[model samples]
Target: MLNKFLDEVCSHIRCKMAHNDIRAELTAHIEEMQSAGKPIDEAIAAMGDCAEIGAKLDKQHKPLIEWPLIGLTAVIVIIGGIMAFTNDYVMNHSGSDFMRFLLFAVLGITAAAFFMFFNYTKLRDFTWIIYGAVWVIFIGSLIMGTRGNVSYVFLNWIFIAIPLLVAFAGFMDKLRGKGMNGLIISTLLALVSLIPAVLTARRAVIFLLVPFFIMLLAAVYKRHFGVNIKSQKAFLYSGLALTGLLVILSVIRNPYRFARMTDFITNVPEGNAWLISALRDAISSANWIGGADIVYSYAPSVAVPNLMADFALANVIITFGWLAGIVLVAAIIALIVRMFMITRKVKHDFGYYISLAACVMLSMQFVISVLMNLGMFPFMGVSLPFVSHGGTGYAANMVLVGLILSVWRRNNIIGKVPRENKNIQPLVEYADGKNNI
Candidate 1:
């Protein structure tokens, strides 16, 4: 409900006092001119561009770096590296193994910094191209992966497609406004990646499906494009129930494919229980303080197939003790909560959706990975985001973090904002012989 003058003022100035004072000065001038039959737009336009005024205000209010959040991430990265170092397997088992980890970390940090400083909305122009390319590469990989294990290429596709899909969803204003579009979008987006997961590896579709639900809920709750599912109680509960049932059924039907999913409930061993059992024992061995070194771990090495990547948090407890694991978990949760806070301040719905999607994706990864590692969930091979050591998952996740940082940067600057702020009348009025309108 902002007037043109106020809206224009906000675009340039981040200082609240300057905004209010200048807006107050212009309000009566605008109203009086309108009362005299002068169009409001003309009156507003006569006040001159807010840029010079904003430039004056910019000296008073500059965007500061989010050092606390950055500090937390740096701490987490250092801890992850330290955890990897504690493993005799990573340090002494092979040459260049540790170097590969360092490379991914550096790449991740670089990508994150690039996105944080760049103009995020510029992607709006290229989103369609990015979206089309994602589907093309992914679908092509899915087809090729069917013949043999092309998972490396497929993983690359998944990494590229996910963030780009989030970007694309942010820009789909028309589609968003059309109501059943959430359901349509949910199914389509879920299926796009789900198909690849199912074709290549069954029962891992949770990664694909979780984001659909997350994006849908975020869009609805935030009222992006004003779309609604209607029947909140029925929709939310039913959607969750259906998802749970599907997960249960997916595990039950494919016992051979998964590692003893119903161990707690059914007490029956499945064909693929070996790796799962090893992972579970490794996680469960820790009490308040975890094992000091990987030599003492229940698992032979952190260099084991799933140990470093999939069961990383479990590996952390094994190497650093439960206290460090608790700290790691708390740090991760804090970062996710920070993302929610940032999402609230974003001025654009597109940016909002991107932030929400990033939060959703990261939260989903952590929850699924932790549960799987601890032997409480069925989805296997999920990585613990930045904490895990794989190049692909780690780098892709860092890019998502970059997306979150991009949104946070946008949130910091008050600007040509969304529709809700338009048409708003100024609250503070003042006499200004200053600008001589």
Candidate 2:
């Protein structure tokens, strides 16, 4: 009985060894045959039964892992949280609990809509229609809008209209699985839309100039580094020409912008002494960190009431303190860097354009907000993104974020590189063999 058991154990070991050798030899032979230009089935047939080879190859090539969506989800959630927190602060300062809730609710819905819209993958088809609607809203703002000043319009309609139009257009296109032509067109349309705002706002046109010029720079950058080679020269020249005309017109109307330009050039004492003083006072009033809850009030020293809108950064510094101010600025910088990195990784034109536009929007807000607070640039009522205390500004920024998320999602789906399996032979071997034949 002992001898029989030992013999049986030996037989089992030999069988296992034979099976392992067969697998290794079969795998190597398949690679060799493929490299020598044999068809996959024929190569398998030459080695052994077709059924066995098919089963093994099928198991080897089966997808073992799926792409991670969590990172992208986290980014979207973080942006939404930032927006909500800022909106809550603004609403609380205004002493309107209802508005605070409303703002947060709108922001939450907007974030959800963005996630859903980008996930669908048809954002490229409605480029022209979406583009046209952007223009229509701008024009409509001129006709039916209430005036803030000679050149400023209270066309809050645009804030609502632009997002809805983009969503519908993006949704339609995503269903069709097209490229982001709509996104490209929408960006160009945003440029054209700025024209009417400039024309209507007249002397107040500096508001339009700052955003439009920054956007133009973004477009040029996208064309240069983002692989958009179509009619780039025309777009660049047109933007430059429009900016020049606006600069000339601005000089004629509000000599202050030109004066600031001259002051900047001549190194005049355009120092923001009053603004800086107010900022210092505000900072001293609150804790350096975790004091975003404090809302101190201030009346502008007579020389800078118009600077109220422009001096929001100073206000934030005063109310939140220097450390909070620095943190805010650092956050903006980090966001811009993130955008640049995302754009660089995007291989598709639509994704690249969206990321480029977002970077432009955020960068413009950051530079202008800082300059306005520092009193380097003329006051232009432009609110800082994610930090400013305005419903319209916050909502508009959310829409921009949504569109960016859409582009980013599509880019990941189409352009993600697959991980390599060391067990598998190189795909190029089969192709090289065919070429030789």
Candidate 3:
């Protein structure tokens, strides 16, 4: 009778993903009725007509298409294409760079579409495997690198770092109930992600480590670690202190890094000073709408090598004027703000963690890129998310955006049981009276 009833109810539900949840809920309702001394028939009848109940559930569980996010993404993509095209036209006097930009944008959009439909929950089953794979690849690259291949081995760590960020969130989900042991393990796991930075690019490592920690802190704050409030706070401070100590130690040990850190403060135009000087001058001379006067007077001086990649934001400001740059930065910030807001709406642990991770990572990269261009921060290997011309970086960011949208799409359907009511397990037994049926 139960199986037959469920089949009938599920027949009315169009979303197959909601079927298991519907079954669990309705079965629990019937079990409650039975506990109240009602017979099986009475319990089954207690639920409303199967079709009506299923229809209502279907309505409640339908996927949400967040138009605001879609609109924001469209705006950024269009603006990025314009910025890339115009900058290329000014620089190379041809459309080759614009053509390359279109190719990568298409590739990125395709990746976004694929991950948007991909069931992110499936990543749970292989979370540890994914975690291990990231480390293996990171380590293997260095081990396999010969002097001739050093550039290949170390430079592309961003690809490895992005996966680590995603996988770390899933890993945190797996550690939820383990208490202090889980906290210690997660700290170690996160710290390992930073060690590679000392050996490779610190900027790429910062990209992974900062966002990775943000997710960790968020998880702890949300009580995902099953730790008490006091322990959570302690963990938070301890993590921060450790990070500070590491930074101090690294700066003291590395003269080049220390010098770069102090350059902004000391007003010293030493290493990479020419690029920074040109960027500052371009911004100061740029008109509100048209191109910078500096560019017209002496284009080659301000036309740095990475005008399309690491310094795309600067290029936008110099080529299209400060107003255009401000609008672009504001739009990117608004998008990141929207993503962070969406994290609060996510029901599942994995969804919230992953989305938060991506949001913070994107936010950090965007902030650093802006500051770097403004000469307020040292130049780094960071890119302005979608506006940058690097194919790999753009595609990776699109993947992150796709993952966030995926979580938001299913926000209504994949319901989470509240912590307070978690012990009331639904008796989903199928064995009793099944043989007779």
Candidate 4:
């Protein structure tokens, strides 16, 4: 009967790492009871049934798949493909671009589902590997030359780097426990990402950089960086103030950038008014529903230069009119907001950061794209995540969506430790020496 109890447990338990420890713990519990004057049979009987307990633990360890959330996002992206279908370039170019959008959209959703349903926590192991791969891309891009056409790897590194930033939050959590070295260690870890951003030299890198800092600061503010929350926040506000000052400095230092900034603001240069004027004319022509002839005839240049990329939203508003644009923008804002709401369910610091990072990245790009179209900001060619027609952009965006979904599905759940089996017990019948029913 003594041997039978361990055998039943060993057979039911799946994670081999915990097997021996569980065995030792259970044996000690029985021996402790025996030493307290109970007989072996009575002591073992006190432990109860192993099978019932094992089943409960099994449920806790299993990965959950949130089908409704996954399906909603999948459908949203596909619905976004609607914008691509009606665009001037999409229709005239034999629909090849739209086809690419569909293919990559599917690929992205599939990749995300694969990651989502799997053990996402295992990704913490390769956080640095993701960081290293992005660094490799940055270095390779430099050697290959950033001019002319960009490579696939280089273009998608932003998406890859964002996930690494999310995972890095867990590393920060460890350092927070380390005292003074914790802040230094976490700062160095952040530099891994900044090196690549500086090398790329794309002002647009702000799309990725902002969230990394926001989330890193948020995590650190929550004590993931070993500093008091108030201290980290003071530093965060100081950094923001400094960033604004530098932007002002940058515009002052660079003649061309400043000229564009000034022209965008006041339209002082009649020459640059064409860009802003074109956007206004396009929007104005769409009298709630759209006067397609007016936009094509009066504001052709606005949609022509980057119709399907940076200006996809402009195309949607023009073609489909005000209601369509409002609905699409609302949907995107809702998606980001929903992501934040989901983060509340995530217990781990890294999971919270990943979900929030994706939301911030998507939100920043959307806001910037709209601002760029309206001539409020210089054109940075940032694509609207789901709406943009680029393959790499769409695929990367979908994957991030999946990552958010993965965080939600697996929130606070450990990969291998079954909740029910956490406390195994000796079968009461066997423990009582009544081996048979």
Ranking by lDDT: 3, 1, 4, 2
Over 11-67, each residue of candidate 1 has an lDDT whose tens digit, in order, gives 777655346555654576677778889786777677676777667766655654666
Least accurate stretch of 10 residues (summed lDDT) in model 2? 61-70
On a 0 to 1 TM-score scale, where does candidate 3 land against the true structure?
Answer: 0.91
Query: How displaced is residue 328 in candidate 3, in Å?
Result: 0.6
Error of 1 at 70 (Å): 2.2
Candidate 2 lDDT over 38-130, as tens digits, reads 876666557654455435543433321111222333343343344334524643433342354356546744763565365423445665565
RMSD of 4: 6.5
Clashes of each: 11, 9, 0, 5
Q: What is the lDDT of residue 246 in candidate 3?
A: 83
Q: Give TM per candidate.
A: 0.74, 0.54, 0.91, 0.78
The all-Cα superposition gives candidate 1 an RMSD in Å to the true structure of 6.8
**Whole-model lDDT, model 1:** 0.64
RMSD of each: 6.8, 12.9, 2.9, 6.5
Q: After superposition, how far is residue 128 of candidate 2 from its true place, in Å?
A: 1.9
lDDT of residue 381 for candidate 3: 74
- Index of the highest-lDDT prediction: 3
